[model samples]
Target: MSREIVLGVDGGTTAVKAVAFDLAGEIITSHHESVPVQYGRHGEAEQDMNLIWEAVADCIREVADALEPDDTVVSIGLTGQGDGAWLIDEDGEPVRPAATWLDGRAGQRVNRWMRDGRAERVLEVTGTTVFGGLFPVLMEELLEADHERASRATTQFNCKDWIRFKLTGERLTDYTEASRSYLDVRDVSGFSTELAAELGQTDLIGLLPQVRAADAPGGVLSSGAAERVGLPAGTPVGMGMIDVAVTGMGLGTVDDGQGWLILGTTGFVGTLLPEVSRRRSQNSMVLATGRGRQVLEFMAPMTGTPNLDWIRNTLGLAEVPWSEIEQRARASRPGANGVVYLPYASPGGERAPFIDTAASASWMGMSLTTTPEDVLRSVYEGVAFSLADCVRTLDMAGDLVVSGGGFRSDLVCEILADVTGQTVVRQDAPEAGARGAAVLALVSARRFPDLEAASQALACPVERFEPDADRGLIYRATKAVYLQAREAIRPVWPVMRGLRYQDSAGDQS
Candidate 1:
């Protein structure tokens, strides 16, 4: 007799991953295909929509090929990176390349909205702060800059929704992705037309896809998709939440007051709430958790492990192993010998804890005496400090659940715990987003009664990093200096941006 397995597909910014898991949530097989991101000189990050779908199909085919002979795939669930504009025409063809969440071309519009109180009107209705990469902002930009292309788009899909549409012919979105844009966190009506009108994006109201509950039944696999992926036709699919919300579910953070963090390409710190809270950071949002009325408040820093990637390559350590890097970081003290590094290395600038499109990374207090080890350690500590900032802004307390590729280092987890002054519970699931999708698929398949029961059955913790009191005290003082230094550099960001623009223009000339 063949055992049943659930397949989960996560289409991320950089890759599309397909993972299969048994009923108990243990991984059975997995495959991933990398999707390229095109970065423009004007702070634009995009991906070819069709190429992304192709990657998804390829990944699924690989996973199916690796499946055991006795293992029969039962259900499919989909999740992906949230935000940005993934638009398609009536024929389901990409009207243009996807403008991802990292795109900052609409920075001027976001700034103007912030200054004119239009952003406030949006926050009042949506419970989300206006940012450059948000759908409405991007749509406004695209409509003004390329009216022809923009007019061709008939429906706006999120990353996963686009993939789901291609697989099951469902042109729908879930509540979680909807909350990132115009959805009122306080209401279940989905899109807020009034909010769209406030932003002068009323034309986009008709382009919005029908919103569905996260655990609801997504359409089944089509014959064409089934043949391409080597899966049986009519395999059930679940409407999965956005990547962040689904990842929280995968971490077993289903109850109110539960918190989680992801230190991946970006750093995210989130706390679940029983109700929508009015008070939130400009960089934080009150997002729907996809469970009825439950919400998540989170701050996402633009860059996370990329700081390490930057320093490693810049310092001629690209070939060096991460174990050596951790060793060097450990050689330095908790405070990194007074050097404070800001982890905003993204070209599009920082978003969470504060929205600054001109923000850039800096190493304050560096001296001739500063050792390489100190610099490396400060980079790690800087990212941790950023996470701590979000935790404090959200007023989150208690033990913090941490995951992602960055937390693989014991030293990173220890630093996070000490800097945040909280116990950091490290969960070792590498494919957390996919696992969460699989959990939702199980519920959609009626194999589980509810999300909580399904998640609890798969909850696994391999290690815990308790905060050191002495180190915590040291980081507290250092964090004060970090904040002071960040504020001091605020005025310099615009000046820096201007200089870069002039330099680029000169190069072009």
Candidate 2:
């Protein structure tokens, strides 16, 4: 008999990646296709649904082409960037460009909901706060603008769910993705209409599909989808999940108390919990796991990798190796000579410990002695500090497992360890999101009884970066300064936001 294969699709911010894996979770082939992000004035970020779907099809075909003719593909799983709203008509055609998770057009609505105590009810149901980038608020804004269009809408799906629907012809979303959509996480079925009514839209609840995890069987691939992607018809398709949760699974951090930090285009700090931890409230979201366990996800939505690219591109320093920058950063003393930076580059403003939509990046305490290296080091440190804030808010004091492209740089791991004062373990796998989706496919196929067992079988080991006690102490002190600066700057943020809003309104008028 030929070896059974599974295909995992990870639709990310920058690209769509497809990985083919054997029954043992070993990767067979991988492919990626870049997708363009559309940015507009007033922090609006969007993506063309048609283009994204084309990229997905291209990636899947590329991966499938690499597979041996005799190898039988058992199932397909999907995981992608979370929270963005993709509106579709009754025929499942996208009505508009998707409001990417990076977009913050719903900030005003989110703020109003939060202030009106709707956020509390949302939290109680969805296990997440009302954030501007989430699908619920975005959907609400879309509905208010055109009630007739919303009334005709059959479903509102996340990126992954939308793609899966294209393949399987099923309208469904996983628990992890649904958790971020202001749906009831406690309700195993789907969104709670009662909670939806409290947020001023009773009908919106009906737009969501049934909730399942990446490990659940979504449906078989339709003949049309199979022919388009060069896959066998009736191939099993597994339910999809949010990218971060699947990344955790891909890292094999399925055990209770095991934590993973993903520093990709965005950063997320997540850990598996036996049950929900209701103690630490702010900055954390509770999501269901692939293996039926609950996870506490603490996200520091904005980190400076994008900023690093911006600085490099704008300053014509793109050719400078990041290694050289790291070496220079190490030569400098801790704290970047009192220079601090705030990395709030996302349009949805900021989430986590502080839900400040008006927050913008800034450099403080720079002097004549400041070098480009100092600024670069501060950017690295600033991103680390944000991650530390999420850790503190969740009280997640455990072995910190790090994954994502950022971990490829040793400097990032060292800086993260020093900042958090915790040992950072780098996982062996780089494409955790794709791997996680494959793991879910395996589970749905009953290759393993659950995610935990699959994790033990598939997880690979890497070096651990332990925190330097002396450096850790220095970071502890600097963290105090960071906190103070954050508080001091809070008052000015609202005024900045008001001005920006006025300017945007004027431009529209």
Candidate 3:
């Protein structure tokens, strides 16, 4: 019998990863390549589209080289970070630097749109609120600043779609990714004309490619792309969605009431819903799951890992292994000696609980006695508290499965369990996004009869970390202090906003 394989590509914010999966949905080999992100002085974060494509090409070739030439790669699936805007010319070459989701330049425009009562219409159409760094807001900003660039643009694509077009010579997007745009997501496919018109770009609807889902085969690889990636010409590629949605599918958390928390560069809390719940209006997004289901995503944009990176860099703690830091953090009592940190290093403000662009990260209640370990532990505790706040707001609290780079630390897992007062299930596979993309590819290729089956085949066993009864009590008590600190800081936000405005005005003058 001939061996059958599938390829999954995940174009992430920091890196592009590719994995080759066997018929049973087991990852045979994986390759990764990091892409550079350019950050400007004015809270601007961007990436070179051409660099992203080069990383993608490198990742694909690496994965293909690891596999046997005769091992038939039946299909390829593409998934990526959502909401970054990529403007391309008629020839599909990017016309501008891709604005990353971390960019906050559009906060003012998004706020104005919200104040004008346009947000409700946007929510009704796109199933998401006006958020900074989203494609529409970024595009609107570009159009306002340089009409020439906006007018000359032929199409607006996300990072993954750009790579897909480069490989297949076909322009298309998946419903899961499309839902993040200001376009309407209520439909299974295509943009919402009503929503597009309200955003002042009815003709912009013509610029978008048709939207599909993971189950649909998007297009075949062109001969040129095939030669570059070491794949057979005409290999089918499945329509892919956002990384978190695919992560949910990869973990087998696709049923209603089942949820997963991904702690990557950003943290996302998501649940798969059987139907689009109107209750999502309160504090969630109802997006397509790319498998004919709806996914409710309650995202918390900042996680603690980045803060740890900051500590390591700023404090010159690179000599110490992260495990040693975790060990020291474990020694500190809950509440980090009454200190707390807000991890908003990316400057796009925050997305969940409150959309405060003026919000900046701080370590409240620090004193002369505060040690580096205390501050570090406080950062971890504070991030867990924010994540807990998001999960608590959900109408239902289900079993929480945790994935991503942060979950590798047992100390962080214990802290999460203690703070959330719930069991934190750790996935067996660390690369949930890539595995999810492969699972989708398998389903699209009919290797699995259904998504659930594909999940069962691909889903790895997880280790559950339950909260300690005694430690849980301490964490609960400390959580009160954390919440109180957060509340106290909320009122001072306006003052901080005033200071920021004055700074901006001075700069302009």
Q: Candidate 1: where are CA atoms >4 Å away?
A: 278-283, 503-509
TM-score of each candidate structure, all chains considered together? 0.97, 0.93, 0.94
Clashes of 3: 0
- lDDT string, candidate 2, 1-509, tens digits: 57788888999998899898876667889899989888866667889988888899889888888998898988898989887778898888988788888887777888888888887777777778677777778778767765675557778889998899899889988777877765555634556778777777777777788877668898999999999898999999988678888887778777777778888888887767765554366556778653444655566565437866766565567787877757766777778788887777665677866778777777777999988777877777777888778877777886788888777778778878987878888986668888888888878878889887766666666788999888888877877887788888878987877676675446744
Q: Report lDDT (CA) for all predictions.
A: 0.86, 0.78, 0.77
Residue range with the least summed lDDT across 10 consecutive positions in model 3: 274-283
Pairs with backbone N, CA or C atoms under 3 Å apart (clashes), candidate 1: none
**Positional deviation of residue 336's Cα in model 2 after best superposition, in angstroms:** 1.7
Worst 10 residues of 2 by lDDT: 289-298
Highest TM-score against the true fold, candidate: 1
Model 1: per-residue lDDT, tens digit, 58-104? 99999999987878787898999888999899999999999998888
Q: Per-residue lDDT of 87-180 in model 3, one digit per residue for the tens?
A: 8889888878888888877777878887897766777776776677877777888787667877778887887888889889888988777787
Error of 1 at 120 (Å): 0.8
